[model samples]
Target: MRIALSSYRSKPHSGGQGIYVRHLSRELAALGHDVTVFSGPPYPELDDARLVAGRATDRATGPASRQTSSAKRAGATASIEPMSIEPTSIERASVEPPNPGRLRLEKLASLDLYNDDDPFRHPDPRELRDRIDVVEYAGMLSGSFPEPRTFGMRLAREMRSRSREFDVLHDNQTLAPGLLDIARGGLPVVTTIHHPISADRRLEIEAATNPWRKYTKWRWYSFVPMQARVARASSRIITVSETSRDDIVREFGVDPERISIIPVGVDVETFTPDAGVAKNAPGIAVETSAPGVDVETFWPDGSARHRVPGRLTTITSANVPLKGLSVLIDALAFLPQDAWRELVVVGTPNRAVETQLEALGLSPRVRFVSGISDDDLAGLLASAAVHVVPSLYEGFSLPAVEAMACGTPVVATRVGALPQLVHGTDGETSAVTGSAGRVPAAHGGSAGPRAHATGEADTSADADGSDAGILVEPGDAHALAGGIVSLLESEETRTRFGRVGRRRAVTTYSWRAVAEATAAVYTEEIARC
Candidate 1:
């Protein structure tokens, strides 16, 4: 199959879009298909993603030069070779995108207004040569996110000359108005919305205290209406979790039949357990540098990777409010000093979070690591006493899946996909079936009933609680703190959850499986068209 994949901004190191694009394209190519990715700034990094478009591009320098924010690209240092295709190398109509079993990347030039180099930059009069550029500039001036809508317009224009060039078009959450135009051009279309943007707008607006901030959030998410319209009209829709699926049905009013659930996967090879580094005890290190153990085992030939005792960690692609970084900090404050020692966040620094840490006197105990490799992250998870997903919502968390693959037990909120991914069951029943309280550490412990918000009950738990990891109510710092404290206080329970989680991640969320399912969707949509 010849698949044309599209995305707006893809930060290779941190964000979900880049990770999804890279891994999925690689896996699809491995399955004997030709995949050409049409992406905006900060293009994805792929082994064979060197696809050249027959047409000219706006930015010839590619990912590095197009980057807008230094913070967004804090750890995004890997560089791709300059695009070697010259102007008029090939006409738009005459194209050959590698063989059936390869992947290529094509860069789509964008106005790039929100670049950190000069945020909300004023476009030179000469730079606004096209209508798309003008629209992008005007949207930025209005404090509204215009990338999705503008990127779609650009993509629609690019596809005008060759609509039948590919078997199907797979859009990566860029639900701009132009997608309807693409589908009308006789191309099979599939849009994968991780979650409803409406939820983001609501959460950000609610999180804001200032009325001006609330108004700005409302203005920023104004594009969501167009997204909902496009989502409703698309031939097929894909989402990561049932939570997101439900939200899309309710929030966007898209028919449930139009949506298909295809969860994301982790690289099992990169995220495996390290037996050399001993797992830290609840609040202390177990001694990795003692006796015959080599120090190199603890520290690979990489950058600084200090293994903190009693390490509690979480990952966020961006330090946004919906991710619940503040909630995590609040939960940490609820614990005693000895209950949990240090926190390690895997993302660029945020000033708001830093200020919160300073106010709570957790400045010294918390550390943020960025730009690390998958191997480094796997090792870190293996060394952690507990991994946490304290987000207010999630649409299938890759970080949680990766941690589980690394055999690290997780403590996550009972919202979105966290419950299903941590619960060792499918999307529906896993979260509700588990007991709320701690799993007994004693061998052959009796089970309890299903738990409620303000009350407790008994259910049949996996004596080992291996059926799932610990889950707490969303936005409740007290419940989150109790869940973490319970895991830290018992090594037996943590070990069981970690073992079960690892098994679930390895067996359930295979990249091959995900690619196969996605390809099946492509085949069905193509046939329908």
Candidate 2:
């Protein structure tokens, strides 16, 4: 199989794009398929044995120069490497404040400053857009967000000119306007909706206060309509979790039959319990470190509970509001002092969540860990007794999953497919079925007569109370904190839940299984076409 995966920005460290491309391609390559990833800047770091493409260099000497020179050299020898195709690179104007830490050019006339942030500038957007049989372009870029639509337009243009080269086209959530044409063009198309943006949109809107703020929120989510359309047009759709699948059905009106659930898997090898087993817990220092402890374990959210001496605690890998950093901080406020703690949020810092935390008087307890690695993260997760995934919503909740994989119990919101992913230690399930509160009567109205006949009344009453960890109403900080506190204090229950979560993660969530399931879908879609 010759597969082309299209991603606008392939940040290896953050989000699901890197996870999807890296694991899926590795699995496919293992199965003897030729996978060529057609990606934008910060390309995937594929194994050298499987691929040959651009290597990152300084801005003065990037892949484009190397490729052009190599092409000329190859022309001289009349030989070219297979899959040695040059990727598209675009230069645009960067408006970001220059890094003061690094040497800067003082107003050198701003003449043709080569900024690569713009996706359309890359010739490969047009080239691969035309050439690849299947382009899995990422939808969630900074703003221009043209992965689905542009790929469709480019695919349609190429199909018209070349008379069909691909059996099917797969999209990764961009759901651009161009996809409608690709669908109308009679090509088999499938799009993966991790979950609908509607949930995030609604959360962001509710989280906003002023009119201009709400308007800005709307502008950021402007691409959602495109996704809704592409989702409707595609022949089949894939989602990461059953939670998300049901969300799509309710939110996007996509039929459940058309949607398939292929759960995302973590790299167990990279995200295992032992990866950081040797490291001493971060911020905790003893006159003599414990034997077999190598890296520091951080518990920013729950660090106040553990008086691990000398380790600098950090949390909030991405300090965005969606990540529930504010809620974690809120939970911290409920705790007494002398638990001295700090956190390091992983991604670009956002002051809004931090400022809110500060306003609540919990700022001293939290610090953001700006840049870190998966292995370092594994070390942190391994040493910590509790890892919090306070996100209001998540497509797959990678951090929580990775935390569980590392034998650390996770305290995640029972929202957005997370409950389905993480099981309770007591093997108990929450009473709440979906986010729509308690289930109503079968015909309509309250569960009166129907409840009696089916015993739903007793069931509903039983499920009402929090079970395992906690099941709070979505976005309710008080309830979320209560759940975190309950779980954090009960060492016995936490250990039980951690054991169950680890077992579930190891048995059910493996990239090998995910790859097989995904490949089955690819085969089925191609067969249909």
Candidate 3:
């Protein structure tokens, strides 16, 4: 079927939206469906090669007439192409290029907008530049975030003009007013809300220390109400996890029946274990605000593993309190200086985080690196003693799962979907309780003894039962530290968790399976329409 996937802004490296759009669109296309993605800056870096391959296969096997019929059935007509060019007229157009002077002028006009340090921010064709500008302009005008609403307007306008171009429209969390307009115009629309934005807004507001910051955060998330309304009105709603579905239903006031739980998939190919890479010693990797790592600092001998004694790796793109970077830092401080050597951070640190590190005397021990390629990240995960995700909240922790896919043991907070994703839970029970209770008491490992000692045997069973990884209470630095320390101290336990985690990640969260499941959702929604 012809599917139009939409995202207001798809920055693949930065957020889940971009990753979702890029992977899902590719997988859908791979399934013999026609998929076209509509996105705003920074646009997604799609696997155009895959789409090209699919088109080539189609051309090789199908006759022109049959191809046309198939295209019509899939809604892949002139209306859907960026600029429909007739096959017969293509040679004439190639021979007689557009006026060179006019072309140069157009290029010059867009040079500033297109040329930037970020490769992803490059301009698309001139025809779509104006539409992209609308989203950018709205963001500037609001002084906060207005892309969703503005992009919606632009999307609605385009879709209305080409209403028959797509059989179904799949929106990636951009529930703008224009979506409502398009839906009302009789388009079969399905929306995927990774989770409620209200959760982010609440976490930010609660984390705010000053009134101005809290107010600003409130104003920034003003678009959430519109999102909630749009989601409720949408024909179908898709979310990544049961926890997310519950949060959406409760926070957005949407009917539970309207929501479908489909967990996000990890690219196992890019995140697989590198048996050749040796694990690093006593140190930690912290990703601060800055991108890219200083090789000399983290890898003195140009080795995949760090030279430090006991190394820990943690990645946090944003230094927001919700990420619990500060909590992790505090946990690090609680450990003896000699216990863990260095902290390798993948992103840059904010002023507040820097101050906290300094106060804890961890400033010297932390190494910040950013902009590492996926392969490098996988290698880092494989080489680390343990991967820690200290987020206070998450819809789904992709980093944790990615680490698991790399055969790395993870120590994550039991918040949102972390418990279910890291420490596998009984699906039937989780659906009822909305919590992956404690790991079963029968399971062996450092977790069982710790749980019993803390008088948390009943609650702890939910966590200790799983051989995948360790889960600690959210915001509990001591508990997080304990889990990390426990894993670091025992190679046998860490190896076991890593092996189990990899198996779970591959079997349960493969992109192929996720794509098939998501396609089923689309088929069901379209049939209903």
Candidate 4:
């Protein structure tokens, strides 16, 4: 079977979209399917598969290609073309590379010349007047997010012309207007929403201080309109977790029956534990270049586990607000420290969040890293005793799971599908809640942290249950600090949680299992069609 996967931006390090495209395409190809990814700029590198670059597309390409051809005709044998050898034979040369900048333009036109029967190709208008309105462009002009809409429109154009070449169109979260048109055009379409963008929008709205800021955040998320549209049109909707599935149903008003909970799997081949490190350390490492900061710090003892490190060497990624860096910072205040620890966050720092960190008097204890290598990250996680994931909500906490996979204990919030992913035997979980409606905080190091429910019966936070790791109130810095201290102070609990978390992650969240489940959904949908 041949499949075409679509997404707007797919830079490997950008985030989930890149990760999803890379792994899913690999898994699908490994299963003996021919997968061709039709993406825009920063196209994915589908290693080991026949990943044909789609039509070289952009506004300037058409004119650029035409200009290149005209230039070539005027001076045939005088000058050599920079982009490619001017069509070798005079008869074969109709279009020439206009200029280096316009090579993409000619390439778009050259697509059909090289591959005639490749039906999974988008249309390249023959005449300039034949072009149609790009709703995506219009949406962008209106201050609504536009990539998804544009990508969807392009996808629909391809599906209508080349629907016979592919078995189905698998959309990677670009819920665009044309997706429904493609589906209604009789091609089977399936979509995977890693989670909803609406969740981000909601968080941004809450974070906004004024109406103008709120309106701007809302405008930036204008893509939600397209997502909602494509999500409803998809024949089968796949998401990373039950938490996400429920969120989509509630947020998008989609029927629960239409959604399938297929968790995204990690590539264990590239994510195994390193055996060199003995004990992991957490501390702060300040930057000399950063404004208003002096020396780096390290805290070897868990006394101020979340503090800045003077001699400490560690790396963390904290671009995600849900990752709970703020709570971690708050926890730092509870520890006894005088700049003895260093923590290097391997990503962009949220200056706003950083201001709060500085106000906590921890500005000297943190280091921010950008463009870190995978080996460095893996080595860092491998050496660390603990990797903290202070998220308020998570569909499937990858950082926590990845840390465990690297043999490190994770201190994560008891929210979303985290408990299901982290806890085993369900004994510790059920004991806390009992039959009654009240869930008591498990208390200090000896008592274990409490499992306060988040007003949900199924979640680990259920005021009525017990679970692995500490269950704390969402966005509560104090409770978050207490939970981190409970685990940090006890090596036994950390080891126990690490082992159990690794076991669960491997047994349930492996990509092989996820792909098999996802394939089954594709099969079922095709059968229905």
Two-way lDDT contest, 2 vs 3, winner: 3
- TM-score of every prediction relative to native: 0.82, 0.68, 0.76, 0.71
**lDDT values, one for every candidate:** 0.69, 0.49, 0.64, 0.53
Instruction: Find the candidate with the highest TM-score and give its number.
Output: 1
Angstrom error at residue 215, model 3: 1.2
Best-matching candidate per lDDT:
1
Please report how far candidate 2 places residue 504 from its true position, in Å.
1.2
- Each prediction's total of clashing residue pairs, residues at least 3 apart in sequence or on different chains, is 7, 32, 43, 42
lDDT for predicted candidate 1 compared with the true structure:
0.69
Off by more than 4 A, model 4: 49-138, 275-323, 338-340, 424-450, 453-468
Q: How far is 71's C-alpha from truth in model 2 (Å)?
A: 36
How well does model 2 score by local distance difference test? 0.49
Superposition-based RMSD of candidate 3 using all C-alpha atoms, in angstroms: 10.5
After aligning candidate 2 to the native by TM-score, how far in Å is the CA of 179 from where it should be? 3.2
When sorted by lDDT, best at the front, the candidate numbers are 1, 3, 4, 2
Residue 161's lDDT within candidate 1 is 86
Give the least accurate 10-residue stretch of model 2, judged by summed lDDT: 67-76
